[model samples]
Target: MSSPASSPSAPPDTGTRHITATILLACLGVFVSYLPVVGVSVALPVMQQALDASTEGLQWITDAFILPTAALLLTCGMVGDLYGRKKTYLAGLALFCLGCLVCLTAGSVVQVCVGQALTGIGTAALLPSTLALIGHVIPDPRKRARAIALWTAALGLGLSLGPVVNGVIVAHTSWRWIFLPSLVLAVLTAVLGAVVLTDSRAERERHLDIPGQLLAVVAITGLVYGVIEGGSSGWSSAQVVIAFVAAALGAAGFVVVELRSACPMLDMRLFKSSAFSGAALVMAVTLFAQVGLVFALSEYFGLVHHASTLDIGIRLIAINGFTVVLGPLVGRLMNRATPGLLLVTGLVIGGIGALLMNAFQAGTSTGEAALVIGVLGIGIALAMAPITTIAMDAVPHRLGGTAAAANSALRQIGSALGPAVFGVILTHRTLATLPGHLASSGLSPADQGQVSGLVSNVGIQAGAFLHLKTPASTGQAQAAYGASFTDALHTCALVGGIGMLVAAVIAVALIGIRPARSPQTAPEATAHPASAAS
Candidate 1:
């Protein structure tokens, strides 16, 4: 296909109208791509009832989308560079819309998983293309940076709003209706992009690294599958063991292939720069903590606190919603503070928030939880943009697109791992403590048997506990289940808190201030010369 840059359809002038249209389309593209990820977290309880899905099934619903997106992101970016960004982006929107339709009509959890995987494939193409198109259309460096900041804000807005939108939908209508808005937005974005976006690609020929891509897919899938299944099946089960082993082999093969490939999906040399490596590590750990915490808290609010879907969304907004306001402010702070300093400060604050959440009790109020969540929101807002800037700055401009993809892929991998790991912890802890809680209750043998039967097969969702009919039994069951759920949430909070603390330490040690350079020196050494520290 001919590059969009070479097409005769280029706009006569890069006027205000053209730029606004391009930025809005890019924002919509990003917003729709991320909306479903956290939105589904709020809808998991409803899904469990509607589809009779297990906890593992719910994890698969999220991971099925995340795994493909993480694995294919770099490859898709390269495809956009070699082919045409506009073409790939349009194709992604179409595929995403198709996936939404399948999900809307899904009758079973397996069908939902299939649809999620398809949507993930579409996102893999959409994300990188959106960013690449911005760089292509906005030739001026200052304008390009501003446009990218707006794109970042849109991403944060989507993440923040997903739960709120899903909550409203679930409260009033079926959770299936959640996809309708996204579908509509996707169609609008596709139409606008076709009219406004200029076609563009890399100046040089690029080759797809199929073997490396396949290895990455297999490795992430195996590892996540092992984690998710190990919680249900015994950890030492044959299936879990085989999955872990296969993941190890796939990971090893991926490293070897990338090191040797002429056109690697991920250039291994990026890791040689401590700033790049530190930024990438921060991205992974932050998402790990953030995503896992959101999943665990969503369950806590719904099952333990008996909050409605809208209430749960409002509660979560305290944690995620601040990004919209704080992102651009932090972007401005990039001029005053080193990216390393900003990252360290943000991680520390986020860690403190997680630690505070660990103090939650069975009777904790929504107001109390929101207080800590707001703190986390601020921390995340401070860290996210700076880390992105640092990672992009660490690479040469020529590799800027690749660097962004790599950072995003690692972040998605962390996102996928978070739910799996936290879910395992939540499930195991709840199960281990349930018998004790039940034994202490003044229940007759019949009631005990009934409650045991109800809870033994399900996760910590309220649907299982809500089945108790008698008032006395229901009260006892709620108390027991709430206590167990609180304990599990605390454990998850501890894990997430410690992960962020580690990230903070890594940032301090590895992310250094930029060295001083002569004014006459060429800017190629640092990818973002404008933001480089003295």
Candidate 2:
């Protein structure tokens, strides 16, 4: 917390060391922020076992981290613009590391969620700072594009590595141990950032938009809470209706607050540019499909296939591994290919990949599943860097921090909604179809009653693979559970697939208009130093 850094972008010189350090730390910062997303995803079944999490509770684990990250990203970007990027980076790392420590020893699911929220806050701070620092440190468009690609690749690498790391940790010891490596990485990055990073900020003055921020949080939180709870308690329930109403008011209020504010954290007029708005929507949709599929598939592999933690992680590699391998290349390709072209193409391919998952069954082979997953990953890799590139390019360099934060925030919002929305689909689908699946399994009358009661009380997660020991009598029950769950998985996959295709159509219509393409043409913000924390 120092005075406003209305100074120029930092590391004043483009020396090899400065550029190298900035890129490295930026990559690592994103790496640390995303490590938990899929890493914890692959461990969901194990976590369910260890913590006794019900279906909704499991979704909360992921959303707990994502909600805060989504809610605070814009505000945190303001912090970087007002304070220093390095300060925000360091602060973010410290909070993330502390959250890891809390998770490492957490005994209950709620405690783990509390820890995740802390990491989410840290993630919110880290994301915009890292990207903005890169923008500042690398002034050349080509070099910045490459750096952003590499930054995105690092995110892919983190996601790719999470399952492997978590798998090994869970294989050897407790699921809690999964947080240890991330904790270590956060500490190392913070220390290095403290030494190597230089301070930078928005060239223009910025202030906190506390009212807007609060409304954003309320809108996002209420929306997610309603969707998730609506699935369990009837969608028509009083609680769900109230939550939806609150969310609508909150969203409308945020827009009003931003419109009237002297110093808005995010200028409402920015969306007037099609590229900026399209990228935001696409970012949310892409993550919504990708993350939601992972949540559903993780359960499928673990529960239906009876895969071990290591097995589950290994199975998921193709989904993120392709992204890790292709990210830098995609960056290069952007120089030649139009971002809109690449973006639309990726969405189509990813949509196809998601639709293919409808073929996945309890007995599907690993090789069979790998093909679809690989396609999905490749599609995602192609789209990921472009979203960042288009969003950054659409805005002036001075607004890089705002653009990055907005992009990252939308991403997390989609991520939070993914589990909430997908989990609801899976829950309702499984429950609706479970009776037929169970009856077909030829379960004894007594067993049927008991199993139905268990699902009723504890949710569908009561039938985890670990709980379905394979005795002659129990074999029928396991098969029934598998059939029901896979049916749900297919439904989830279809939802994701259709979502991707729709996003593709959206990309075609937008991501091209750039009315305020240049800094000189763009409208300027009002000057107001008045501030408040979100």
Candidate 3:
């Protein structure tokens, strides 16, 4: 039996063309799939009014995309291994295009949700297949690391650029234009992928792990639904409780199924590597922290700050604008520092940024907020590329899809969970703070209730700004509301700070810093082809 690495492809020297082409092709999928999350947040009020959507229906529009993406990621990874990365990615692009068309024409909330779900599935396919293809096409460790860094940077670019594009489109045209750009981009990507991407499939023939896949889908959906809904349902509500229980059972079943399956959706044995485990945890937690910040930032800028939808998008973009510029620079730096060192340093910087925002008062100027956001962006750039490199490099060639899929899954889950969990914090804090303000000198109970309700409702709007109403009675409400928002910010910052500290500790203690060029430690380093050899 041939080693998986040696089965078909040329050695590392010959794979660069295929790798570059595939990465370019993969960028389209990343852009289309993730752009909606940010863009739609900016467009939610438009969507709500256009469709006359209920609050629950509006939430579903987002959840429809997230749940399916998280659930199907692992399965799609397996599919890439069983079939071929090129095949899977092409199919994904096709599916994504179809979903965008559906969204463009949707007259009802259900149709939008359906469209989102389809897009989510397509995204699942695109993500893992791209990573797995990288593993096949980039055979040299150094080149592969650089390639992975670029891949991650591309993903970050997609995420960062999504809202900016959406803002531009929505400002000039209708919300439907959001789908239009992606539709065109998707078709273009499909054509590019067809032309440039080579077919690369697994060497070992293995059946799909149906049981494991099913259980995983169940587990992830349950967990995501529970977390997302927990805020509205009240954590102690029967529905929330049931969702939690179902998630627990499903997750437990998935473990058992994977253990017994001949070809597992996830190989548990990989966790035996402390480096891999620590890296994975950092990816998940950092995403949790970062996404939470993004979520809150969207709300604060649009609703609380009373910025225009386009202004909100532009402002947020300005905050992270530096990151898009700095990411490649960091990628070059990774050639010098160990992944562990970069990861810890990035997390520390990002945590500080978050803490700064948490310390924010309603009195904070937009410039101050934007500066803090820029810091967070830099921190994300510093860590994300290196951490992804470490995790992907630790695993073997055959399981590349699985490892990538696992990483994507955790990241998505963290993103999903962050908003839901933090939204609750923001909500409670706002509500508690508003009542004292509502008790002002002249206001009746009925008017106070109305103002309080509106404040809460507005706070939930992403990319919208909020303002507190001064109570009729004295200047009571303004002071209290300020104090409350400040308290919430502090609490959020502290939580984020703790998470970063933990990540740093894990990084320093569990993840050893070896120089990136440690030829003595990694045999592959010495095996690189010299220019003469090439």
Using lDDT, give the best candidate's number.
Answer: 2
Candidate 1 per-residue C-alpha lDDT over 177-239 given as tens digits, one digit per residue, 9 for 90 to 100 = 888888899998899888877776665567899999999988998999999999999899999
lDDT of each: 0.80, 0.85, 0.70
Give residue 470's error in model 1 in angstroms: 3.4
Ranking by TM-score: 2, 1, 3
Error of 2 at 445 (Å): 3.8
How big is the positional error of residue 168 in model 1, measured in Å on the Cα after superposition? 1.8
- Ranked by lDDT, the better of candidates 1 and 2 is 2
lDDT tens readout by residue for model 3, 344-378: 88888888877777657766787887788778777
Candidate 3 residue 195 Cα shift, in angstroms, is 1.7
Model 1 misplaced regions, further than 4 Å: 1-20, 137-145, 444-446, 462-469, 513-523, 527-534
Instruction: Give lDDT for model 3.
Output: 0.70
Candidates ranked by lDDT: 2, 1, 3
Name the 10 consecutive residues with the lowest summed lDDT in model 1: 525-534
> All candidates' TM-scores?
0.93, 0.94, 0.88
The predictions' CA RMSDs to the true structure, in order, are 3.5, 3.9, 5.1
| Candidate 2 lDDT tens digits, 1-534 | 343333543334578898899999999999998898799988988989888888888999989999999999999998988888889999999999988998999999999999999999999999999999998877666677789999999998998899988999999999999999999999989999988888887766677899999999999999999999998898999999999999999999999999888878777767877778889999999999999999998888987887887888888887788778998788877776677788888889999999999998888999999898988988898888888888777666667788889899999999999999999988888888878888878777777777777776787877654243348647787778788889999999999999999998888888652222232332223121111211
